[model samples]
Target: MKKSLEKLLNKPLPVDPFMPQRAVITDIEELAPDHKKFSFAFCDESVNDSWNHIPGQFVMLTVPGAGEIPISICSSPTRKGTVELTVRKVGRKTEVLHRLKPGDYVAIRGPYGNGFPVGIMEGHNVLIIAGGLGIAPLRSLIWYILDRRHRFKEVYILYGTRSYEYVLYKEELKRLRERNDLKCLYTLDKFETEEDRRWADRKGLLTELIPMVELEPSETFVAVCGPPVAYRFIGKELLKHGYPESQIFVSLERKMECGIGKCGHCQIGYKFACIDGPVFPLWDTKNLPEMI
Candidate 1:
Protein backbone atom coordinates (compact mmCIF):
# COMPACT_ATOMS: atom_id res chain seq x y z
CA MET A 1 0.00 0.00 0.00
CA LYS A 2 2.87 2.37 0.73
CA LYS A 3 4.34 1.93 -2.75
CA SER A 4 0.95 2.49 -4.38
CA LEU A 5 0.25 5.50 -2.20
CA GLU A 6 3.59 7.04 -3.17
CA LYS A 7 2.67 6.73 -6.84
CA LEU A 8 -0.55 8.74 -6.66
CA LEU A 9 -0.62 11.42 -9.43
CA ASN A 10 -1.17 14.29 -6.97
CA LYS A 11 2.38 13.86 -5.62
CA PRO A 12 3.45 17.44 -4.94
CA LEU A 13 2.10 18.42 -8.37
CA PRO A 14 4.30 19.11 -11.41
CA VAL A 15 6.82 21.93 -11.33
CA ASP A 16 5.26 23.56 -14.37
CA PRO A 17 1.56 22.82 -14.70
CA PHE A 18 1.27 24.60 -18.02
CA MET A 19 4.40 23.24 -19.70
CA PRO A 20 3.74 20.44 -22.17
CA GLN A 21 5.94 17.38 -22.44
CA ARG A 22 7.04 16.22 -25.89
CA ALA A 23 6.04 12.69 -26.76
CA VAL A 24 6.30 10.59 -29.92
CA ILE A 25 3.49 8.49 -31.29
CA THR A 26 4.75 4.92 -31.27
CA ASP A 27 1.78 3.07 -32.69
CA ILE A 28 -1.75 3.69 -33.90
CA GLU A 29 -4.57 1.15 -34.03
CA GLU A 30 -8.03 1.72 -35.43
CA LEU A 31 -10.35 1.05 -32.49
CA ALA A 32 -13.70 1.74 -34.16
CA PRO A 33 -15.35 3.95 -36.74
CA ASP A 34 -13.86 7.44 -36.32
CA HIS A 35 -11.90 6.26 -33.24
CA LYS A 36 -8.23 5.37 -32.86
CA LYS A 37 -6.01 4.08 -30.03
CA PHE A 38 -2.68 5.86 -29.91
CA SER A 39 0.49 4.74 -28.14
CA PHE A 40 2.94 7.40 -26.98
CA ALA A 41 6.35 7.57 -25.31
CA PHE A 42 7.79 10.77 -23.89
CA CYS A 43 10.64 12.19 -25.92
CA ASP A 44 12.55 12.84 -22.71
CA GLU A 45 13.40 9.57 -21.00
CA SER A 46 13.43 11.30 -17.62
CA VAL A 47 9.84 12.40 -18.01
CA ASN A 48 8.76 8.94 -19.11
CA ASP A 49 10.59 7.34 -16.21
CA SER A 50 8.96 9.61 -13.70
CA TRP A 51 5.41 9.42 -15.04
CA ASN A 52 2.71 7.87 -12.85
CA HIS A 53 -1.06 8.29 -12.83
CA ILE A 54 -4.22 6.69 -11.50
CA PRO A 55 -6.85 4.92 -13.60
CA GLY A 56 -9.27 7.82 -14.32
CA GLN A 57 -6.82 10.67 -14.93
CA PHE A 58 -6.56 12.48 -18.28
CA VAL A 59 -3.99 14.38 -20.32
CA MET A 60 -4.26 17.59 -22.29
CA LEU A 61 -3.03 16.81 -25.81
CA THR A 62 -2.10 19.45 -28.35
CA VAL A 63 -3.33 18.89 -31.90
CA PRO A 64 -0.50 20.84 -33.49
CA GLY A 65 -2.09 23.86 -35.17
CA ALA A 66 -5.72 23.16 -34.40
CA GLY A 67 -5.72 23.39 -30.56
CA GLU A 68 -5.65 21.21 -27.47
CA ILE A 69 -8.18 18.85 -25.94
CA PRO A 70 -8.32 16.77 -22.77
CA ILE A 71 -8.27 13.01 -23.25
CA SER A 72 -8.35 10.22 -20.72
CA ILE A 73 -5.36 7.93 -20.35
CA CYS A 74 -6.52 4.46 -21.32
CA SER A 75 -3.35 2.58 -20.34
CA SER A 76 -2.88 1.09 -16.89
CA PRO A 77 -0.18 2.52 -14.67
CA THR A 78 0.96 -1.05 -14.04
CA ARG A 79 2.18 -1.11 -17.64
CA LYS A 80 4.53 1.81 -17.48
CA GLY A 81 6.83 3.45 -20.10
CA THR A 82 4.43 3.75 -23.04
CA VAL A 83 1.09 5.53 -22.53
CA GLU A 84 -2.14 4.99 -24.42
CA LEU A 85 -5.01 7.35 -25.33
CA THR A 86 -8.13 6.32 -27.21
CA VAL A 87 -9.48 9.28 -29.17
CA ARG A 88 -12.68 9.61 -31.15
CA LYS A 89 -12.85 11.97 -34.12
CA VAL A 90 -15.29 14.59 -32.87
CA GLY A 91 -14.37 18.22 -33.40
CA ARG A 92 -11.51 20.35 -34.78
CA LYS A 93 -8.76 19.33 -32.33
CA THR A 94 -9.48 15.62 -32.62
CA GLU A 95 -9.91 15.94 -36.39
CA VAL A 96 -6.31 17.09 -36.71
CA LEU A 97 -5.07 14.43 -34.33
CA HIS A 98 -6.71 11.71 -36.45
CA ARG A 99 -4.51 12.67 -39.37
CA LEU A 100 -1.29 12.03 -37.42
CA LYS A 101 0.86 9.04 -38.34
CA PRO A 102 3.17 6.88 -36.28
CA GLY A 103 6.43 8.67 -35.45
CA ASP A 104 4.78 12.07 -35.49
CA TYR A 105 5.28 14.16 -32.35
CA VAL A 106 2.67 15.65 -30.03
CA ALA A 107 2.76 17.67 -26.82
CA ILE A 108 0.76 16.75 -23.70
CA ARG A 109 0.28 18.03 -20.17
CA GLY A 110 -1.43 16.33 -17.24
CA PRO A 111 -2.44 13.05 -15.92
CA TYR A 112 -5.03 15.52 -14.57
CA GLY A 113 -8.23 15.29 -12.55
CA ASN A 114 -8.86 13.47 -9.31
CA GLY A 115 -8.75 9.85 -10.39
CA PHE A 116 -10.60 6.89 -8.91
CA PRO A 117 -9.45 5.90 -5.42
CA VAL A 118 -8.67 2.27 -6.13
CA GLY A 119 -7.17 1.84 -2.66
CA ILE A 120 -10.54 2.32 -1.03
CA MET A 121 -12.10 0.06 -3.62
CA GLU A 122 -9.79 -2.80 -2.66
CA GLY A 123 -11.27 -5.68 -0.58
CA HIS A 124 -14.68 -4.97 -2.10
CA ASN A 125 -16.43 -6.33 -5.14
CA VAL A 126 -16.06 -4.01 -8.14
CA LEU A 127 -18.76 -3.04 -10.59
CA ILE A 128 -17.59 -1.15 -13.69
CA ILE A 129 -20.17 0.14 -16.15
CA ALA A 130 -19.27 1.92 -19.36
CA GLY A 131 -21.20 3.22 -22.35
CA GLY A 132 -19.95 4.50 -25.69
CA LEU A 133 -16.61 6.37 -25.44
CA GLY A 134 -16.88 6.29 -21.65
CA ILE A 135 -15.03 2.98 -21.73
CA ALA A 136 -11.78 4.82 -22.44
CA PRO A 137 -11.04 5.77 -18.82
CA LEU A 138 -12.72 2.71 -17.36
CA ARG A 139 -10.37 0.56 -19.47
CA SER A 140 -7.44 1.79 -17.40
CA LEU A 141 -9.20 0.95 -14.14
CA ILE A 142 -10.21 -2.46 -15.50
CA TRP A 143 -6.62 -3.35 -16.30
CA TYR A 144 -5.36 -2.01 -12.99
CA ILE A 145 -7.79 -4.21 -11.09
CA LEU A 146 -7.20 -7.21 -13.35
CA ASP A 147 -3.44 -6.90 -13.05
CA ARG A 148 -3.86 -7.12 -9.27
CA ARG A 149 -6.82 -9.44 -9.09
CA HIS A 150 -5.92 -10.74 -5.65
CA ARG A 151 -6.70 -7.42 -3.99
CA PHE A 152 -10.40 -7.46 -4.83
CA LYS A 153 -13.26 -9.92 -4.67
CA GLU A 154 -15.68 -10.58 -7.53
CA VAL A 155 -15.26 -8.24 -10.53
CA TYR A 156 -17.89 -7.45 -13.12
CA ILE A 157 -17.49 -5.42 -16.30
CA LEU A 158 -20.73 -4.28 -17.90
CA TYR A 159 -20.24 -2.39 -21.15
CA GLY A 160 -22.89 -1.17 -23.60
CA THR A 161 -22.42 0.36 -27.00
CA ARG A 162 -24.58 1.38 -29.92
CA SER A 163 -23.50 -1.59 -32.07
CA TYR A 164 -20.73 -4.10 -32.62
CA GLU A 165 -19.00 -1.83 -35.15
CA TYR A 166 -18.75 1.01 -32.62
CA VAL A 167 -17.35 -1.09 -29.78
CA LEU A 168 -13.74 -0.27 -28.99
CA TYR A 169 -11.08 -2.86 -28.04
CA LYS A 170 -12.90 -5.70 -29.77
CA GLU A 171 -10.00 -8.17 -29.54
CA GLU A 172 -9.14 -7.15 -25.99
CA LEU A 173 -12.75 -7.46 -24.86
CA LYS A 174 -12.88 -10.91 -26.45
CA ARG A 175 -9.84 -11.94 -24.42
CA LEU A 176 -11.44 -10.58 -21.23
CA ARG A 177 -14.62 -12.48 -22.03
CA GLU A 178 -12.60 -15.68 -22.16
CA ARG A 179 -11.15 -15.15 -18.70
CA ASN A 180 -12.61 -17.09 -15.76
CA ASP A 181 -11.61 -14.73 -12.96
CA LEU A 182 -14.00 -11.89 -13.78
CA LYS A 183 -17.49 -11.54 -15.24
CA CYS A 184 -17.68 -9.61 -18.54
CA LEU A 185 -21.09 -8.77 -19.96
CA TYR A 186 -21.85 -6.73 -23.06
CA THR A 187 -25.02 -5.21 -24.55
CA LEU A 188 -25.73 -3.61 -27.87
CA ASP A 189 -28.49 -1.25 -28.92
CA LYS A 190 -28.75 -2.77 -32.40
CA PHE A 191 -27.38 -5.68 -34.36
CA GLU A 192 -26.40 -4.99 -37.92
CA THR A 193 -25.44 -8.57 -38.65
CA GLU A 194 -25.56 -12.10 -37.28
CA GLU A 195 -22.05 -11.66 -35.94
CA ASP A 196 -23.15 -8.66 -33.91
CA ARG A 197 -25.79 -10.72 -32.15
CA ARG A 198 -23.26 -13.42 -31.43
CA TRP A 199 -20.84 -10.92 -29.90
CA ALA A 200 -23.36 -9.35 -27.52
CA ASP A 201 -24.59 -11.18 -24.45
CA ARG A 202 -27.74 -9.00 -24.43
CA LYS A 203 -29.57 -6.32 -26.37
CA GLY A 204 -30.96 -3.05 -24.86
CA LEU A 205 -30.03 0.06 -22.89
CA LEU A 206 -27.10 -0.17 -20.44
CA THR A 207 -29.50 0.46 -17.55
CA GLU A 208 -31.25 -2.79 -18.37
CA LEU A 209 -28.03 -4.73 -17.71
CA ILE A 210 -27.70 -3.41 -14.11
CA PRO A 211 -30.47 -5.58 -12.73
CA MET A 212 -28.56 -8.71 -13.70
CA VAL A 213 -25.61 -8.10 -11.32
CA GLU A 214 -25.76 -10.33 -8.23
CA LEU A 215 -23.24 -8.76 -5.86
CA GLU A 216 -24.00 -7.78 -2.27
CA PRO A 217 -24.88 -4.11 -2.48
CA SER A 218 -22.95 -3.03 0.60
CA GLU A 219 -19.71 -4.77 -0.32
CA THR A 220 -19.34 -3.36 -3.79
CA PHE A 221 -18.01 -0.12 -5.23
CA VAL A 222 -19.39 0.93 -8.60
CA ALA A 223 -17.66 3.01 -11.27
CA VAL A 224 -19.78 4.34 -14.12
CA CYS A 225 -18.96 6.38 -17.23
CA GLY A 226 -21.48 7.08 -19.92
CA PRO A 227 -23.80 9.59 -21.57
CA PRO A 228 -24.80 12.36 -19.16
CA VAL A 229 -28.47 11.64 -19.78
CA ALA A 230 -28.02 8.07 -18.58
CA TYR A 231 -26.71 8.98 -15.10
CA ARG A 232 -30.06 9.60 -13.43
CA PHE A 233 -31.44 6.29 -14.65
CA ILE A 234 -28.30 4.37 -13.75
CA GLY A 235 -28.03 5.99 -10.32
CA LYS A 236 -31.65 5.15 -9.56
CA GLU A 237 -31.13 1.58 -10.74
CA LEU A 238 -28.10 1.15 -8.48
CA LEU A 239 -29.87 2.72 -5.52
CA LYS A 240 -32.87 0.51 -6.19
CA HIS A 241 -30.49 -2.42 -5.84
CA GLY A 242 -29.32 -0.98 -2.45
CA TYR A 243 -25.87 0.26 -3.43
CA PRO A 244 -24.78 3.33 -1.46
CA GLU A 245 -24.36 6.61 -3.27
CA SER A 246 -20.99 7.20 -1.56
CA GLN A 247 -19.51 4.06 -3.07
CA ILE A 248 -20.58 4.77 -6.62
CA PHE A 249 -18.23 6.92 -8.70
CA VAL A 250 -18.69 8.37 -12.16
CA SER A 251 -16.22 9.94 -14.58
CA LEU A 252 -17.83 13.05 -16.01
CA GLU A 253 -17.51 14.50 -19.49
CA ARG A 254 -16.89 18.24 -19.37
CA LYS A 255 -15.37 20.70 -21.78
CA MET A 256 -12.17 21.27 -19.82
CA GLU A 257 -9.46 23.38 -21.43
CA CYS A 258 -6.74 24.27 -18.90
CA GLY A 259 -6.23 21.05 -16.98
CA ILE A 260 -5.38 23.03 -13.83
CA GLY A 261 -8.92 24.48 -13.53
CA LYS A 262 -8.14 28.12 -14.31
CA CYS A 263 -10.14 28.08 -17.57
CA GLY A 264 -13.52 27.69 -15.77
CA HIS A 265 -15.03 25.84 -18.74
CA CYS A 266 -15.70 22.70 -16.70
CA GLN A 267 -17.55 24.18 -13.73
CA ILE A 268 -20.18 22.04 -12.10
CA GLY A 269 -21.98 24.05 -9.45
CA TYR A 270 -19.13 25.67 -7.49
CA LYS A 271 -16.54 22.92 -8.16
CA PHE A 272 -14.27 22.76 -11.18
CA ALA A 273 -14.34 19.40 -12.89
CA CYS A 274 -10.73 19.70 -14.04
CA ILE A 275 -9.19 19.75 -10.57
CA ASP A 276 -11.96 18.78 -8.14
CA GLY A 277 -13.20 16.03 -10.41
CA PRO A 278 -13.95 14.59 -13.79
CA VAL A 279 -14.21 11.67 -11.31
CA PHE A 280 -16.66 12.18 -8.44
CA PRO A 281 -18.85 10.19 -6.11
CA LEU A 282 -22.36 9.51 -7.41
CA TRP A 283 -23.66 11.47 -4.43
CA ASP A 284 -22.26 14.67 -5.94
CA THR A 285 -24.58 14.37 -8.92
CA LYS A 286 -27.58 14.56 -6.64
CA ASN A 287 -26.34 17.51 -4.63
CA LEU A 288 -24.91 19.51 -7.51
CA PRO A 289 -27.24 21.49 -9.74
CA GLU A 290 -27.52 20.31 -13.36
CA MET A 291 -24.90 17.61 -12.70
CA ILE A 292 -26.51 14.85 -14.67
Candidate 2:
Protein backbone atom coordinates (compact mmCIF):
# COMPACT_ATOMS: atom_id res chain seq x y z
CA MET A 1 0.00 0.00 0.00
CA LYS A 2 2.83 2.44 0.86
CA LYS A 3 4.76 1.66 -2.34
CA SER A 4 1.63 2.29 -4.45
CA LEU A 5 1.14 5.72 -2.78
CA GLU A 6 4.75 6.72 -3.51
CA LYS A 7 4.38 5.81 -7.19
CA LEU A 8 1.11 7.73 -7.48
CA LEU A 9 2.65 10.99 -6.21
CA ASN A 10 5.23 11.13 -9.04
CA LYS A 11 6.98 14.07 -7.41
CA PRO A 12 10.30 15.30 -8.81
CA LEU A 13 13.16 15.74 -6.36
CA PRO A 14 15.78 18.50 -6.45
CA VAL A 15 19.48 17.86 -6.93
CA ASP A 16 22.65 19.90 -6.95
CA PRO A 17 23.21 21.96 -10.09
CA PHE A 18 26.53 22.65 -11.83
CA MET A 19 27.72 26.09 -10.83
CA PRO A 20 30.48 28.34 -12.15
CA GLN A 21 33.65 29.04 -10.21
CA ARG A 22 36.52 31.50 -10.55
CA ALA A 23 39.76 30.29 -12.07
CA VAL A 24 43.15 31.91 -12.77
CA ILE A 25 45.41 31.76 -15.80
CA THR A 26 48.34 29.43 -15.15
CA ASP A 27 49.79 29.34 -18.64
CA ILE A 28 49.17 30.38 -22.26
CA GLU A 29 50.64 29.16 -25.54
CA GLU A 30 50.31 30.25 -29.15
CA LEU A 31 48.85 27.35 -31.12
CA ALA A 32 48.74 29.12 -34.49
CA PRO A 33 49.80 32.41 -36.01
CA ASP A 34 46.72 34.12 -34.60
CA HIS A 35 45.30 31.63 -32.11
CA LYS A 36 46.39 31.34 -28.47
CA LYS A 37 45.62 28.38 -26.22
CA PHE A 38 45.19 29.45 -22.60
CA SER A 39 45.29 27.21 -19.55
CA PHE A 40 43.62 28.13 -16.29
CA ALA A 41 44.05 26.49 -12.86
CA PHE A 42 41.41 26.85 -10.24
CA CYS A 43 42.73 28.49 -7.09
CA ASP A 44 40.47 26.35 -5.00
CA GLU A 45 41.47 22.70 -5.30
CA SER A 46 37.96 21.48 -4.55
CA VAL A 47 36.55 23.42 -7.51
CA ASN A 48 38.98 21.75 -9.88
CA ASP A 49 37.59 18.30 -9.12
CA SER A 50 33.99 19.49 -8.84
CA TRP A 51 33.93 21.49 -12.08
CA ASN A 52 33.00 18.87 -14.61
CA HIS A 53 32.33 19.73 -18.26
CA ILE A 54 31.60 17.99 -21.52
CA PRO A 55 33.04 18.45 -24.97
CA GLY A 56 31.54 21.36 -26.98
CA GLN A 57 30.60 23.30 -23.84
CA PHE A 58 32.05 26.85 -23.53
CA VAL A 59 33.28 28.98 -20.64
CA MET A 60 32.73 32.70 -20.23
CA LEU A 61 36.21 34.24 -19.96
CA THR A 62 36.46 37.67 -18.39
CA VAL A 63 39.24 40.24 -18.31
CA PRO A 64 38.82 43.36 -16.18
CA GLY A 65 38.64 46.09 -18.89
CA ALA A 66 37.80 44.01 -21.93
CA GLY A 67 34.56 42.38 -20.70
CA GLU A 68 33.79 38.73 -21.37
CA ILE A 69 33.55 36.29 -24.27
CA PRO A 70 32.36 32.69 -24.58
CA ILE A 71 35.11 30.34 -25.67
CA SER A 72 34.81 26.60 -26.17
CA ILE A 73 36.51 24.36 -23.61
CA CYS A 74 39.19 22.85 -25.82
CA SER A 75 40.59 20.37 -23.29
CA SER A 76 39.00 17.01 -22.53
CA PRO A 77 37.51 16.27 -19.12
CA THR A 78 39.93 13.35 -18.86
CA ARG A 79 42.63 15.95 -18.47
CA LYS A 80 42.83 17.14 -14.90
CA GLY A 81 44.52 20.00 -12.95
CA THR A 82 43.63 22.71 -15.49
CA VAL A 83 41.32 23.45 -18.44
CA GLU A 84 42.37 24.73 -21.87
CA LEU A 85 40.83 27.23 -24.31
CA THR A 86 41.96 28.13 -27.80
CA VAL A 87 41.12 31.67 -28.85
CA ARG A 88 41.69 33.41 -32.18
CA LYS A 89 42.55 37.10 -32.07
CA VAL A 90 39.46 38.25 -33.89
CA GLY A 91 37.97 41.18 -31.97
CA ARG A 92 38.56 43.57 -29.08
CA LYS A 93 37.90 41.09 -26.29
CA THR A 94 40.07 38.42 -27.86
CA GLU A 95 42.76 40.97 -28.51
CA VAL A 96 42.75 41.69 -24.80
CA LEU A 97 42.87 38.00 -24.02
CA HIS A 98 45.91 37.71 -26.22
CA ARG A 99 47.64 40.32 -24.06
CA LEU A 100 47.11 38.30 -20.90
CA LYS A 101 50.17 36.41 -19.65
CA PRO A 102 50.97 33.61 -17.21
CA GLY A 103 50.31 34.47 -13.56
CA ASP A 104 47.97 37.25 -14.58
CA TYR A 105 44.54 37.00 -12.93
CA VAL A 106 41.31 36.54 -14.96
CA ALA A 107 37.71 35.68 -14.12
CA ILE A 108 35.72 32.74 -15.45
CA ARG A 109 31.91 32.54 -15.21
CA GLY A 110 30.84 29.16 -16.57
CA PRO A 111 31.10 25.98 -18.55
CA TYR A 112 27.79 26.74 -20.20
CA GLY A 113 25.78 25.49 -23.21
CA ASN A 114 24.76 21.95 -24.12
CA GLY A 115 27.71 19.78 -25.10
CA PHE A 116 28.04 16.88 -27.50
CA PRO A 117 25.81 13.93 -26.58
CA VAL A 118 28.70 11.51 -26.07
CA GLY A 119 26.68 8.75 -24.40
CA ILE A 120 24.14 8.72 -27.19
CA MET A 121 26.92 8.79 -29.82
CA GLU A 122 28.62 5.72 -28.41
CA GLY A 123 28.73 2.55 -30.52
CA HIS A 124 28.21 4.52 -33.76
CA ASN A 125 30.48 5.65 -36.54
CA VAL A 126 31.38 9.35 -36.14
CA LEU A 127 32.50 11.95 -38.66
CA ILE A 128 34.07 15.20 -37.50
CA ILE A 129 34.40 18.12 -39.93
CA ALA A 130 36.38 21.25 -39.11
CA GLY A 131 37.38 24.25 -41.23
CA GLY A 132 40.14 26.78 -40.44
CA LEU A 133 39.98 27.96 -36.83
CA GLY A 134 36.77 26.03 -36.34
CA ILE A 135 39.01 23.16 -35.31
CA ALA A 136 39.46 24.80 -31.92
CA PRO A 137 36.09 23.73 -30.55
CA LEU A 138 36.00 20.45 -32.42
CA ARG A 139 39.37 19.60 -30.91
CA SER A 140 37.69 18.98 -27.57
CA LEU A 141 35.30 16.45 -29.06
CA ILE A 142 38.06 14.76 -31.02
CA TRP A 143 40.29 14.37 -27.97
CA TYR A 144 37.48 12.98 -25.83
CA ILE A 145 36.51 10.46 -28.48
CA LEU A 146 40.10 9.41 -28.94
CA ASP A 147 40.59 8.92 -25.22
CA ARG A 148 37.75 6.39 -25.12
CA ARG A 149 38.31 4.82 -28.54
CA HIS A 150 36.78 1.43 -27.78
CA ARG A 151 33.30 2.70 -27.02
CA PHE A 152 32.61 3.92 -30.57
CA LYS A 153 32.91 2.40 -34.02
CA GLU A 154 34.95 3.78 -36.91
CA VAL A 155 35.88 7.46 -36.48
CA TYR A 156 36.80 9.86 -39.28
CA ILE A 157 38.04 13.42 -39.20
CA LEU A 158 38.08 15.77 -42.21
CA TYR A 159 39.91 19.03 -41.54
CA GLY A 160 40.35 21.90 -44.03
CA THR A 161 42.28 25.15 -44.00
CA ARG A 162 43.21 27.95 -46.39
CA SER A 163 46.79 26.69 -46.61
CA TYR A 164 49.11 24.19 -44.96
CA GLU A 165 50.41 26.94 -42.69
CA TYR A 166 46.89 27.68 -41.42
CA VAL A 167 46.23 24.15 -40.13
CA LEU A 168 45.63 24.34 -36.37
CA TYR A 169 46.44 20.87 -35.03
CA LYS A 170 48.85 19.47 -37.60
CA GLU A 171 50.98 17.40 -35.25
CA GLU A 172 47.99 16.07 -33.36
CA LEU A 173 46.20 15.18 -36.61
CA LYS A 174 49.22 13.31 -37.87
CA ARG A 175 49.51 11.36 -34.62
CA LEU A 176 45.80 10.58 -34.61
CA ARG A 177 46.01 9.27 -38.19
CA GLU A 178 48.72 6.81 -37.19
CA ARG A 179 46.40 5.33 -34.56
CA ASN A 180 44.44 2.32 -35.85
CA ASP A 181 41.39 3.51 -33.96
CA LEU A 182 40.65 6.44 -36.29
CA LYS A 183 40.96 7.70 -39.88
CA CYS A 184 41.95 11.29 -40.68
CA LEU A 185 41.92 13.49 -43.79
CA TYR A 186 43.37 16.97 -44.25
CA THR A 187 42.43 19.34 -47.10
CA LEU A 188 43.35 22.82 -48.28
CA ASP A 189 41.38 25.41 -50.25
CA LYS A 190 44.10 26.02 -52.88
CA PHE A 191 47.52 24.71 -53.71
CA GLU A 192 50.02 27.19 -55.07
CA THR A 193 52.20 24.61 -56.87
CA GLU A 194 53.08 20.94 -56.61
CA GLU A 195 56.52 21.83 -55.18
CA ASP A 196 55.06 24.33 -52.69
CA ARG A 197 52.65 21.73 -51.28
CA ARG A 198 53.47 20.02 -47.99
CA TRP A 199 50.03 18.47 -47.54
CA ALA A 200 49.31 16.14 -50.51
CA ASP A 201 45.80 15.27 -49.34
CA ARG A 202 42.52 16.60 -50.78
CA LYS A 203 42.13 20.16 -51.98
CA GLY A 204 38.87 22.19 -52.17
CA LEU A 205 36.08 23.27 -49.88
CA LEU A 206 35.06 20.75 -47.18
CA THR A 207 31.71 20.29 -48.92
CA GLU A 208 33.34 18.85 -52.03
CA LEU A 209 35.31 16.31 -50.03
CA ILE A 210 32.14 15.09 -48.28
CA PRO A 211 30.94 13.40 -51.46
CA MET A 212 34.24 11.57 -51.86
CA VAL A 213 34.19 9.99 -48.41
CA GLU A 214 32.33 6.71 -47.80
CA LEU A 215 29.77 6.96 -45.03
CA GLU A 216 26.42 5.43 -44.24
CA PRO A 217 24.17 8.44 -43.77
CA SER A 218 21.81 6.67 -41.41
CA GLU A 219 24.46 5.03 -39.25
CA THR A 220 26.93 7.93 -39.12
CA PHE A 221 26.70 11.07 -37.00
CA VAL A 222 28.21 14.29 -38.41
CA ALA A 223 29.53 17.23 -36.40
CA VAL A 224 30.72 20.40 -38.19
CA CYS A 225 32.45 23.49 -36.79
CA GLY A 226 33.51 26.44 -38.93
CA PRO A 227 32.74 29.96 -40.03
CA PRO A 228 29.24 30.97 -41.10
CA VAL A 229 29.92 30.23 -44.77
CA ALA A 230 31.41 26.81 -44.05
CA TYR A 231 28.44 25.84 -41.90
CA ARG A 232 26.01 26.80 -44.67
CA PHE A 233 27.67 24.72 -47.38
CA ILE A 234 28.77 21.70 -45.30
CA GLY A 235 25.35 21.39 -43.67
CA LYS A 236 23.65 21.45 -47.08
CA GLU A 237 25.96 18.75 -48.40
CA LEU A 238 25.31 16.53 -45.37
CA LEU A 239 21.58 16.89 -45.86
CA LYS A 240 21.93 16.06 -49.56
CA HIS A 241 23.74 12.85 -48.66
CA GLY A 242 20.59 11.71 -46.79
CA TYR A 243 21.90 12.30 -43.27
CA PRO A 244 19.09 12.99 -40.84
CA GLU A 245 18.72 16.58 -39.67
CA SER A 246 18.80 15.49 -36.02
CA GLN A 247 22.11 13.68 -36.47
CA ILE A 248 23.89 16.78 -37.80
CA PHE A 249 25.30 19.32 -35.34
CA VAL A 250 26.93 22.69 -36.00
CA SER A 251 28.65 25.22 -33.74
CA LEU A 252 27.75 28.87 -34.22
CA GLU A 253 29.87 32.00 -33.74
CA ARG A 254 28.07 34.81 -31.96
CA LYS A 255 28.99 37.87 -29.95
CA MET A 256 28.60 36.65 -26.39
CA GLU A 257 28.90 39.19 -23.57
CA CYS A 258 27.77 37.36 -20.47
CA GLY A 259 28.15 33.59 -20.48
CA ILE A 260 25.05 33.27 -18.35
CA GLY A 261 21.56 33.56 -19.82
CA LYS A 262 21.09 37.01 -18.30
CA CYS A 263 22.82 38.80 -21.17
CA GLY A 264 20.72 39.16 -24.31
CA HIS A 265 23.52 39.85 -26.77
CA CYS A 266 23.80 36.27 -27.94
CA GLN A 267 20.08 35.52 -28.04
CA ILE A 268 18.61 33.98 -31.20
CA GLY A 269 14.83 34.04 -31.21
CA TYR A 270 13.98 32.26 -27.94
CA LYS A 271 17.37 30.56 -27.61
CA PHE A 272 20.52 32.01 -26.05
CA ALA A 273 23.62 30.80 -27.82
CA CYS A 274 25.54 30.89 -24.51
CA ILE A 275 22.90 29.02 -22.57
CA ASP A 276 20.77 27.05 -25.03
CA GLY A 277 23.62 26.20 -27.43
CA PRO A 278 26.86 26.93 -29.08
CA VAL A 279 26.44 23.50 -30.61
CA PHE A 280 22.89 22.81 -31.80
CA PRO A 281 21.11 20.09 -33.74
CA LEU A 282 20.60 21.14 -37.38
CA TRP A 283 16.82 20.74 -37.19
CA ASP A 284 16.59 23.26 -34.32
CA THR A 285 17.76 26.09 -36.59
CA LYS A 286 16.37 24.94 -39.93
CA ASN A 287 14.33 28.16 -40.28
CA LEU A 288 16.07 30.43 -37.78
CA PRO A 289 17.54 33.66 -39.12
CA GLU A 290 21.20 34.78 -38.79
CA MET A 291 22.03 31.37 -37.34
CA ILE A 292 23.85 29.80 -40.27
**Which 10 successive residues of model 2 have the least lDDT summed?**
11-20
Best by TM-score: 1
lDDT of 1 by residue, 39-83 (tens): 999886656766889999999998789988999999999987899
Q: For each candidate, what TM-score against the reference? A: 0.94, 0.88
The 0-to-1 C-alpha lDDT of every candidate, in the order given, reads 0.90, 0.79
* 10 residues in a row with least lDDT, candidate 1: 9-18
Q: Candidate 2 local accuracy as lDDT?
A: 0.79
Q: Count backbone overlaps in model 1.
A: 0
Enumerate residue pairs that collide in model 2: none
